[model samples]
Target chain A: MPEMVNLKINDISVSVEAGSTILDAAKKANIKIPTLCHHEDLCIAGNCRVCVVEQKGVNALKASCATPAEENMEIFTNTNKVREARKTIIGLLLSEHNNDCLHCYKNGNCELQSMAKDYLVDSDKYISILKNYEIDRSSPSIIKDDSKCIRCQRCVRTCAELQDVNALAVSGKGSEMKISTFMEKPMDYVVCTNCGQCVTHCPTGALVEKNYIDEVWDVLNDPSKHVVVQTAPAVRVGLGEAVGLDAGKSYTGKMVTALKMLGFDAVFDTNFSADLTILEEGTELLTRLKDKIENKKDVALPQFTSCSPGWIKYIEHEFPDILDYLSTCKSPQQMLGPLAKTYYAKSMGIDPKDMVVVSIMPCTAKKFEANRPEMYSSGYKDVDYVITTREFGRMIQQAGIDFETLKDSECDSILGKHTGAGVIFGATGGVMEAALRTAYEIITGREVPFSNLEVTPVRGLEGVKEATIKIEGCKAEWKFLENVELKVAVAHGLSNARPLAAQVQNGESPYHFIEIMACPGGCIAGGGQPMPVNNNIRKKRTEAIYNEDESLQLRKSHENPEVKRIYEDFLEKPLGHKSHELLHTTYTKRKKY
Target chain B: MTEINIVKDAVKKHGRKRESLMPVLQEIVKQENYLSEERLMEIAKEFDLSSAEVYGVATFYSFLPVKPMGENVIKVCQTIVCDMKGKEAVLDAIKDKLNIVPGQTSADGKFSLMAVNCIGQCSNAPAMLVNDKPYINLTYENVVKIIDEYQS
Candidate 1:
């Protein structure tokens, strides 16, 4: 869109777009600059100071990431001064860091490990100042170990700018500087939505999703266990990247094959449960509207969708006073957990107690959520284990499974059947779109006009999105108006949801429905999807979700024959006693400190 | 339900809501001079959360009082900018005069010594907050006299 600027990096001339940083220009010139805090997706923090380069006329070495490239600028990437500064920065970071990489969860794949090797840092140079800081393992999704933190501000930037959730911030300064929540509270008590965007962006072992890989492996190895794995909608779009596949490549077949190799007895799909959620949630909305009009009964206004575990947790913690506004339906992942243990196990003639249900998700919060005591709705542990997409990839590598060569396979029957509406649940605004498709049909009692069901209002990467849908001519005259405008809002990241929640809390806002996802861009950019994600990758993954949605024959949730069959055979009806037992869940407020 | 009723009911009846936690903790600290383990456990159970989670959150933040505070709370800013402007000496003077450690409360409960990372008053250089009130441009000699004024 703009003119290109030519720059010489290590005596090689490279032309990059105007406003490109020296690091980007160097990348174009094939000159390597080691960075810890600078993520392509996250805004440049330049706090790591590891990418310093010697400029021709500058008095001091300039950080390549923060410094903009000028025309005909000469930069030396490997000068002694540049090397010394980088080494010193790495040395300082190492001195403060807990070098217990052997036992650390990040182990061999840690960026800090690779950076140290590339810079040839002397680990023992500086005297270590061991601050007796406590570890925060209070949250279900993440574990915060400040001892290993380099104060690079990657997590802060990811939380604030990228995710639009200011869950983490730099508190104090200098040697005492540490990242903390409001008043240094545990993440669970703060405004954090449990989105693992911070974990994906964290360069070191300081932040990590609590690992459930060991638990899954243990369950799989046990002779008495019948382990079943269900993959979420977003996992198929990004799991390919973890194994060196191109970003946004759909690896549903390879993912299933890999899971089968991982010793899963049956590979299921969470998409089926996603379709189920639309039925229950959509039916609930219609029932509320009907009752409100016919019986003059007051139902909960502004029924917030409870599809994202991170968003659910955020609302539970930050806006507990408005708990009634949240939809009672458990997330599709959570719903699948109970269904797999009880319904599927019974139908297959297997004992529910002997079944271990593992969910492969694009979320870190789902791991934390599965462990919540209330999640066991099937008289046994519904979901026994949870693994992020990255962890699943690591397991594939660990088990020596060739992900690329894996054969295409179909998901298990019964719980695997999904409509296009369910597949698009991977991206933000997808839930609203899917719900509207069903809602329109339910209201009209006929096929929705124009098979190309596109609700363009709720699409895009904006933190908050809104739309007003006018339902035309309905047969249910008592409750339905000719043009009943349904006001809806969708917010992805928790930071954006905070103000919206605050409005609902303060009674200043009114809406018919709301959809909130914890991670920015919804599950497509989940905390567990992939590492080193940029805006481009997120966009590509989101496009893949919509593309999958468009190519499907059954675009509406209500039209899925399997979903209707499940309802008739097992669930009985949407929000029925059986449905409530299987799909609905309650939340509890957490202590601030 | 009315909004006021909801807020009042939540504040008075539901003790577990996170929004109410800050206010409840403030009241508890105000009454007991510090947060008690029993109170924290009660708060945790009320919220359907673990005591460890509550304690971890409590200890992580700087505002929450874990131990009994003195009649007067003396917090000195020891962040980078303050350190550069001689906040350390000011802190040392207060500790020396009171004969108490940074986290200790005096025997008479007249003063509690603590060092905060920053008070966010960069223009004042070395600053101290006494019981939530800011006192800026603090010197070693000035700190002792300031405490003397609070003694009465």
Candidate 2:
């Protein structure tokens, strides 16, 4: 339906759609042009001139990533002049970059390092002009090292365009310019949501997740300590990409096997607590609806899901007025932490003091969430040593374990069981689907009217999705009314969430429940997932999540055996006293700065 | 009016648009001599932008400083023309006179010294500006006397 543009690169004819970049046309002809600041998930940033190519009859080289391909245009990708300019640019960037690769966290995986090796730049040709900047390790989630930055502005663009949380900006100008928070304050002191998208997008070692590998290794080695690890739903799908496996593959059995081999006394699943979250959150939603409809009392409708720590912190800072609208449920990671120290430890006859709870998550914000002052409800820190999925993969490599050769293993009992509803929490609209699967049955005594228990409307990578279900044939405890429409909405990424939140703040929202994830594709494409995340990678992870859901025997959270047992033996009921003390929390307002 | 009122008034004069940020910041610098953290935050709220964004624009220009300054800011040109014409000696003289190096304020809160790029007075080499009033073709004695007159 659209017009096409024909171009010749390296003397090979290629045709691409009109308005496509030279980079796109080159890709169609199988010509690889390397770039540093060009990200598939972000807008075009032509600051890095690494993708320059020669256009015939043009005096100057054009940045291929930013220049649109034209009809019958002749472009040379690997000409001698282009290569020399790229090499010179690489050398110039390295002149200011801290080249202490041995001490850098992103040594082997850094994009700039790979480019430098490919171009074979002379590192010593230019004198070292690296500025002396103290690495800011203030936040528990990420480290900001300005000495290694290349000023590509990819992180700056990601913070502004993708998340709409401009916590980082290019301050100063020219040679003195650097990315900084307000007034160059420490990261934790600012209004950072601690999402770590900047860490994933940074091409160098400028930003990285703070490592707790040594601390985790210590606990595993201590004889008196009992180490237990929990893997989040997204980790199973994302960990594969880090360990040389392709995306869209579930590494659950192998991941559990690797954790067991890494000396964890018990390996559990965060999905078990995710199922628990459905019960508590669903009950709270029903209670609010009852208060508003039956009791004629004012209650915050369109209750927001609180499973994402980054979203929790974002709302606390940017939308403090809507804190009452947020569900009081702690994230599944936090829910499992206190329960592990109390219920699991007591049941397993282990002392709470000896049990060290470690979480393998797809989020960096979980580290910040675990470090909050109020997370000590379990008497000890609820969760200790939160490591990202990438860090876990590194631990497997550090232990000299061949991940592909490991046999599949099942998780430990009590906290290891889960359901399809819980596993789908990795994707954007997953929690809404999971909650509807349970809440509809509770209200109408019937399963959600969907095929194979898959809610199709709320699925995929759309930024915002809305659905409505007409409650019909309800069981009458005392019927307020029947055939009421239950409207729900789902949103991912904080940029999409800000408008929905404003609607709620203005008392003009039309939905009864809202699900928001701070990351683009929810936890599967989280900030702490493998680097170089793109639409293709996010799609692969999302499909793998649904594939995992289809492969499970139990499709509903209420049907999870472990969840039923927990409610019967310990929790007693949803939103009960025991559950409230352990599984829910309050939020604090933060400065907008 | 309070400092926050000055920021609000500037925003009112320049209007709350993205392109108006520069003029608002320049107006603030004209009145307060420097942009403060509180004033930046106030402007951010008025414009519905983030504090980092406002601060980024404020700090990008050397003429609009984010840090507090003394009674008078003395910007010594460090461009090629001035550097070639014995700007270093004049800078050292100012440092000795005020007992402070570049990027620092004097103890008496009278002068803050900074090495800036070209002030566009290349014909008058070894130039300096105290509060936008240029003293061109300077020497160590000229800079010393200038600091003495401003110190009082």
Candidate 3:
């Protein structure tokens, strides 16, 4: 066992790991030290001086987050000088801050606002120097209001650390500092994946999702238009947190009821399209494998999953050369968009133009994904409006619907019906596991070798996970792969995707398929999921997704009757002409920045 | 050699490490006057640095401007020590001479004035740097003389 260091925090003795920070020791001693810049998931940014504490013998107050607790150290978490320093820092931060918390989206949820309240820093104690900055509403996914920024560097770190898409940077010196894109380009013009990872980590209203709730309200209010809403699998698990429900609690029924109360004509599930994606993506992978095995053709192995719009955009910008490696399947959000407009509309005897398909995603990137010009293969624009899970929550609240008290309701038939495989698509390594279930069953005509089909190797929150499956006892068609070791890798966060993509590009990759989710822990911990998101919360959300997958009756995509029926009635086969035209889409190579 | 090639050569000279970032950016700024967005992005890739990391340092240093600069750059120290020695008068003279405020460049591209931090010329209280060349013990007359030299 590691030698523990003993320290006294607030007159209470504490023993912690040798290198534990003073904040950690204080936490152990149950002495609450409020911190603004400290996040459980991010590296220690000691920039925010709110957590400064008085040390008995030290000359100056120490930042508890960055300072390590030494043996026999006497620390005072609550002291007059410490309180003064914190209040002064908060007051100074407020003085320079563009304060319109009354109308701010992060009014109640803001860390700075809460800290000011905690320290009773209501009155401005310093000379107020307000700076005006232009609000960037260029990207469909997210907005950057620099006027409200605190220069905490959370967004900067999130963009760089979590996503490896350094779309955000602190520009200007000292007092004139601001976070901006390279060359100070508009959000859409830069290589920003539009993943709201930055926004989720932002302590203020500086970065936020581009709101379409009002637009959604307008479409919902339109009597002539049929506004149908589809919720992504991740939304079911993550929506709970927004509506005061505990994390890891699946709220499918109540959420559907809430959406109905919000005046959605037909509440659908993106899960159906997720199941459809597995079918198409799986077939594409098998076909590619067969071509390489038989024709000896140079096909890109390690077919990367394209369910994540942020990951898609990242590959487009960073690894443009390996664009072909990406599976041509549109995200479940995009797929449901066209299907709602055409297939669902035609069956419901409504005009496709009159039907507005709205996707409630756990991603900001979905907004950008839905607006892609290539998604308009259904004659009319496929998906009309895209709203995040948070936006959906706001709509529910705006509609005066009691989310907690609402009775559980089921989604409308056809597009709403899905398998457990579809539900698990929200979690990392889920797509790979789901694809394996379908592929192994199709090829071997047997259940996936794993008990309960958990595929334990691929599951969890590791940045990069590799699993090898033995293709044993395959059918005659796939005889070439009999007893062949099929390797696969799963990566979440674009930072993780970078190395995987590079390996594939450089021909150093040793896998048959790769699954990449742009957000940290997949859609469950998506940029648009909830506020105050971290690793523990992500784990809870992941558990909820896994729980949801396990609770569902049908766990395999091929077993999804609606998906089967859609194939039999409309698309006919995976990778078919109609499927290619409607379900699958192409990618554009962006400038490598 | 082409401008892009020259930049690439400078990148090679500096080496593709984080420490080399400052030198690479400085050289680019020296050659290109200011770092372009596209060029910054290119340098980001060449150095394996994030655009944010590159922009952070590039923007933090006033000398390495992210925007276009005037042909002749003027930096006046505005620290307390410099202020006590009539740096403000020299600043006023430069502003009046150039017909611009600090942080603004003259329309003619002759002079760009900036009130910057101290250059450690405490012995000679007021100090300024003209195009990276330091000028010490400045008076309003000397400041005007320096601005006149740049006007030519």
Candidate 4:
């Protein structure tokens, strides 16, 4: 066991580990310490001095977040000096901040606004010295507003640590210090992946997703337009947090009800297309393997999954030379988009032009993904608008709908049906596990060796996970005796994916298939999920995702009735001609920096 | 060597590690007088770092400017001791001679004026650096004479 350090926090004896901070000790003693720069997901940034606490016999107040709790130390969390220091620091921060809360995008959910209210910070205490910075709206996914930034560096740390994409950096020093892109370039001109991890971790209104709520509202009000909506697999588990329900609770049914009440003509599920992704992507993987191992052709081994738009953009920028290794499958959101404008419109007898496809996604990058020129495969724009789960919650609030009291409802027919494997696509290693479940069965003509098809080895919050499955008893017309061990790797967050990408780039990889997600935990803790996401919330959302998968009757993707019917009636088969035009897309190389 | 090759040579002289970032940047600034975005990007590519990270470090030090500078650059100390010692008058004199204020290069491309933090010349209260050479205990005449000598 680790050595424990004993301390007295606010006269309550608290025992914590030796390396624990005084903030940790205060948490143990149930003494709440308000902090602005300390985030559970980032390293201790003591720049924001709001968490200063009084230590006995010490003239200078200690920053509880940066100071470790020593044995026999006496710390007071709510002392007068501490309170005065916090209020003064907050007031100073406000003097530089543009306190236009009424006109701000993050007015209601901003952490700095909450702290100012908690401390009753007098904004007029100091003269206003706010720098007028031009708001950067070059990227369709996120906006960078500098006037309201408090320079807490949480977004900087998040971009550097979690994503390993240092598109943001602390430029200058002292009062002139600001978070900026390279040479102050607009975000679109730089190497930013539009992941929006910076947006989620921002304490102020500095970084926010570009809002399409008003456009969505306009579409809903237009009688001439038949607006159809699709919800991603992660949105079902994550929307609960935005709608004031507890985290980890699946709100799939109620979310559909809310979309219907909001005047959507049809509410579909992205999970259905997620099932379709497995078929096409799985078939592509098998084809590549056959070419490499059986036909003796030079092929890119270890095909990478392409469901995440952020990961797609990252590889395009960082590893442009290895674009051939990425699977040609479009993300489930993009797949559903074209299908909605074409197949769904035809089946429902609605004109494709009049049908506006909106995706309620757990990602901000989906907004950029939908706007890509290649997404216009249906002769019209595939997905019209992409809104985050948070934006959808705001829409529900705007419509004055009681989310909790809404009766649970089922999704509309054609593109709404889903399976357990599709629902599990929200989690990190879910796509790998789902593919293995179907591939193993297809190869051996038996159930996957895993109990109940859990595939426990690939599941969880580990940054990178590797699993090997030995193929046995292969069914073939003229069999070459084979006992091949198929190796697969799963990685979430760009930092973990970097090493794997390097290995692939150098032709040193030892896996047949690799799964990569840009966000930390997966789509469940995506960039556009409810705010204040950390490892704790990520775990709860992952558990809810697994629970959702178990609750469904159809656990395998191929077993999805809608998927089978799509192949039989329309697409014909996975990787077929129809699937190529709609379900698959290509990637382009970007500037290396 | 060209500015691009100079940055590459600096990176080669120092290693690719993070500690070498400073020496590489300082070497470029020493030869070029200021860092261009292109040279910064070249250093970033060679060091395997993001361009924003290199830009951030370059901007953090007032000495390492990201914009082009004139042939002769003048840095006036703007710390408390120099401020109390009539540093503003010294800055005003430089502005009058160069037809430029702090953070601006002259129209003739002869001089650039900047009010930077202390260069540890506090004992000689009001001090300024003209191309790495410090001039201390200055007045309006001394500042004008200093500028006149560099004008040719």
Candidate 5:
């Protein structure tokens, strides 16, 4: 353990770990120091200047978040000078901010709103200097409202440090300081992964997940509607946190009950569709491998997994030339949407137009994805509405449901049945594991050798991982001289994804298969999950997802009965004509603006 | 390579949306020096929109420039980068030599003066971009000399 340091905060004696910042010491001592840019998960960026506190001997107040605590140092946390400084800071920030919190997506929950109230800032002290900047709504997943920005730099730090996607950065300075990316390009065109981590860390409404809650409400309120809700696996582990449940505590049953209380006719699980995705994707991989064995035709080499919308959009914009490498399977959310409006609707004897499919996802990008024109497959809109796990929790609260004592329940049938493989889709390396399970079994016509089913190569939180597996009794060996080696790589986050993608683009990549998830730790740490999920909570959430996977009866995608039924009835076979028409889509060349 | 394609495809798909005209204009300007009439028409058609609508939207945003530009578009950081590092002197030197304000094109159309907020290259203050290539640690004399290389 590190040496300890003693500090006096507000005249109260405090001891903290050596190298701890004044802010950390204050937090330990229960001395509240309001901050905006200083997220624990990210590096200290003293841009907000809101956490300024007085040091007894220092001439000027210093930002506690960036200043280290000196031994025996005296700090005045709530002195008149500190209070006035904080009040002035809040007043200036609010003067330039939009001040539309009543109608903003982050109304009661916004940190800026609470801070203003905390400091009792009622007047616009710096209104004259507030620049009337234009709003940039160019991106689908994010909205850039400069008027609401306090120049906190939380978004920039989260994008750069946490996700390793340095898309946002502090631009300008002082009164004109704001966030922008590469010449103020719209986020959709930049290297932004649309992971929404910035939204979670944003202290103000300047950055927010583009809200589709009203659209969902409208869809649900229609009298002729047969609303169906599907939730991603990640949502089950964290949705309860939004309703005051502890983070990483699996609320699968409570979540189902909450959705039912929200008036949805059925509560389905995206895991079922995830299982279906693995089945189709795994089958596609095997067929491609078999095709390579016979040397019949040129199959798409190095088929990349396409279950992440963030990764999908990323590949479409940043790596369109390698579209062939991407698997045709839509993300589980999209897959479930189309299936609910088509297969589930038919089974329920409901009209596709009357059926409204909503997905409670742990991804903000899904809001943009649901509105995509290419997602329509059933000759009608596939998913009618999309809501984040956070938004769903709000709706649960707005309905006055007591989540703590809610009865546990199971998901509806048909679109609800899923395998353990599908449940693990929330965590990093899960897609790779699920695919391997199905691929090994499909090729050998039997279960894999290891019951543990751990593919160590794709099992960690590393930016990029690689492994090569040899098929027993396979003869297709061009790269390995008569021995077939199944090479694979897994990458999480766009920053790390960039170099790996460049390797593939430059034709220097040696791997035959690749899995990419835009968010670090996959959907378990999605952009739309509960905020303030530190390392501890994330690890717990990931553990919960994997635990759910381990406890399931069917741990392979091929074992899902619904997937088997889909292949038997409508799809016929993986990558067949109907599958191509309904499940696959193409990409377009985009401008860099 | 895959990253580049992802960027390209996202731009292509979202660029075609009517609401994404600003981003489309930004993308076009980033790739090609300016938004050409043909490109504007292409975008308008893709969005099932009128070229006037597209042009109006593009012109409305200060970020989007409309004319064909020089081989290199030099964006001098005027917001804070140049301000902290004496951007006024550099701007004055460029204006004296080129005879144009921040929004004007040079008489020979060899350069266009535009003020950018910040380039995130604050470590090397007084940054100016030649096309998309950022040159930092700039002085008034160095900026003039750098612009001279593109004069003709």
Candidate 6:
């Protein structure tokens, strides 16, 4: 369908589509060109000259990343000159980079290290010109260590382009060049969402999830402490990729077993509270809808989901005026944190103080979320420590547990039970579909007519999607002439979310409810989900999430007996006194700067 | 009147895009000597940029200082030509006379000293700038004399 450009790469003629880079053409010709600055999701930085090649007439070595293929162009990918230039550039990068590869967090998994291995960099001919920079661990989530940075600008592009946060940028020039925040302020003082996408995309250990592994080990070793761990819905689908399983493989059972082996006294699922969130959030949405439709009261329509801490922070800082539209529920991670400390601890007869709650989240922001001043509703830090899936994977390896050999196991009781609806929260549009499944049944007194209760229209890797569900049949007492088309919209990634939030802010939004996940492709493709995330990986994970949902016997959140029991035992009712005290939270505005 | 209005005017003159940020800051630097954190915030707002983005750009250029500059900035040339012309002696003379190192400003806030590589004055051999006005082809005695003249 597109015009093809014929090019001779390494003396092999190849026809690539017009505008394909020399790298792409080279790949078509079975030539592998190494690159450090080129990322699948970011623009061609061309800063790393590792991919330099010889063009027929060009005097200088051409950067294949930024150079587009042309008709009849002769490109040499593995020329001696090209190789030497690449080695020189890599040597320069090595000179600047701290060579503490033996103990670096990204040692085995790093892209640059793999390239250095491929090129067989034998010597550091240049003197080390590494400038010492103090590691910034002020932010609860990410650690910024510029000493290992290669100045690739991948994180800069990720923050500025994908998230639109612009919390980091290329600050200095030449030898003193480094990535920094506003006035080089500490991360806490700046407007960083603490999403950890930067960490996900970083080629080296320059940026990483703050290590709570030591602290976790300390708490685990304590004889008096009861360590309870909850795995986020996104973690099951993502953790597989880290443990040598195919991306998007369902390893939930193995993950739970690993947590047990790691000495987490009780292994819980955030999905339990994810289902709990639906009960509270769905009830709140219906109440607001009742206020608007039945009482004609002033209420914020198109109520936003509060399940993502990054989205919560974005709205807090950028769109503070529409904070009223955000559901007052804490994120499922935050909800489970408090409940594990209070509800689960109380029922188990353990002192809430003695119980240490840790959440294995598909988010770095969860680390920040756990430390919020308001999360102390349980009389202590609700979640004692939060580790990312990446960190958990490391712990599993550290304990020498063969994840592949571990038998499938279920989560511990009390805060363990989860429904299919709860499991679907990993992907974008999942919560909306889950809520619709329950909300429609609650209003109609019948199951959703759709087969498998899979709302196909709401599911996918699309950035933004909207659907209208016509409430046709209804129960007697609630019948106000049913046939109402409930308008709803789903968006993943904050760039897509900003417009949707604006529409609601301007009173221009027509939908009654909206679902927004901050990271692209929801928690499954979250900033902290997996390394080297791409569209293909997200699609794979999305399929797995849906597969997980479809495989479960209980598909709807309302049907989760654990949720019903929690309400009957402690919560009493959704959006009631205890729910408001524990599950719901208020957000304060933050300065945009 | 507000210094921000002048900064806003500079923003207007520099074409009001993110690309114009450095130039706008440069103009503001010409007016206000250096960028303050508050002015950087204002420039960020005016350019519709993030504080980190604007601040990063501000810090990238060596000529633009993020902190306040002294009334008089003294440049001591440390280029090859000036080094051959006994630049270290002249530097020591100025240091002893002004009682300040290369990075520090004088106690009275009158002078800031920097040992710059070159100011495009290779022809002038041992040229230096005491507030952009070159004192070229200088001797160590002349360096001391120049500092005394400025101090008085």
Highest TM-score: give the candidate number: 4
lDDT of 2 by residue, A1-593 (tens): 89999989999999999999999999999999999989988899898999999999998999999999999999999999999999999999999999999889998999999999999998579998989999999999999999999999999898998789999999988889999899899999988898988988999999999989999999999999999999999999999888878898898899999999999999999999999999999999999988888999999998999999999999999999889999999999999999999999999999999999999999999999999887888888999989999999999999999998899999998899999999999999999999999998998888999988889989988889999998888879526537789999999988889989999989999999999999998999898899779889999999999999999989899999999999999999999999989999999988785
* Alpha-carbon runs more than 4 Å astray in model 1: A1-32, A40-44, A67-78, A130-134, A160-167, A181-191, A293-296, A445-451, A473-481, A506-510, A590-593, B1-152
> Each candidate: fraction of true contacts kept?
0.00, 0.79, 0.70, 0.84, 0.00, 0.84
Best by DockQ: 4
lDDT for each residue of candidate 5 in B1-152, tens digit (9 for 90 to 100) = 55344335535767655567667677777777677766765665566543444555565444566666765566888766569878887788788788877777777767777777777888888887877688888887888888787774
Q: What is the lDDT of residue A410 in candidate 2?
A: 92
A316-368 per-residue lDDT for model 5 (tens digits): 76677888888878888888887787777887899998888888899988877
Clashing pairs in 6: none
List, residue by residue over A1-593, the lDDT tens digit for candidate 6.
Answer: 99999999988999999999999898888898888888878788898878999998988999998899999999988878988887788888888888899999889989888877777775748888888789898999999999999999999999987788889988867667789888878998788898888998899999998869889999999989999999999899999887767896878898998999999899999999999999999999888888888788999888999999998998898888999999999988888878887888888899998999989988999999999998998888888999988888888889999999999999988899999999999889999999999888888988876787988878897888999988878887556528878999999888788889888878899898899888888999887776889888999988888898889999899999989998899999999999898889999899787
**Model 4 Cα lDDT, one tens digit per residue, B1-152:** 56467987898899889999999999999998888888888899999999999999999998998889899989999999999998988988987887799999999998988889989999997999999899999888899999989976
- Candidate 6 local lDDT, B1-152, one digit each (tens): 67668887997688887678778888888888888998888888887788888888887765677877788888888779998977888788878877888878888899888777678888877878887788988888888889888878
Model 2: fraction of the reference interface contacts it also forms: 0.79
- The CA lDDT of each predicted structure is 0.82, 0.92, 0.89, 0.92, 0.78, 0.87
Candidate 1 interface RMSD, angstroms, 1 decimal: 8.1
State candidate 4's TM-score.
Answer: 0.99
lDDT of 4 by residue, A116-172 (tens): 889998756899999989999999999999998999999999899998989999999
TM-score of chain B of each: 0.84, 0.94, 0.93, 0.96, 0.71, 0.87
Candidate number that wins on TM-score, 1 or 2: 2
> What is the two-chain DockQ of model 5?
0.05
> What stretches of model 3 exceed 4 Å from their correct place?
none
Off by over 4 Å in 5: A1-20, A24-32, A54-56, A69-81, A122-129, A133-138, A161-169, A181-193, A293-300, A445-451, A454-457, A467-485, B1-152
For residue A133, what is the lDDT in candidate 6?
A: 87
Per-residue C-alpha lDDT of model 3 across residues A1-593, encoded as one tens digit per residue: 99999989889999999999999999888888988788777788999888999999887999999999899999998889999899899998999887899999887889888888888985746877877678899999999998888888888888888888888888877788888887677999988998889989999998999989889999888999999989999999989888777888889999999988888999999999999999999999999999998879999887999999999999998889999999999988888888887788889899998888888999999899888889898898888888888888888877888888889999998898988899999999999999999999999999999999999999998999999999999999999889889999999988899899999989999999999999989999898998889888989999988998999889999999999988898999999988998999899999756
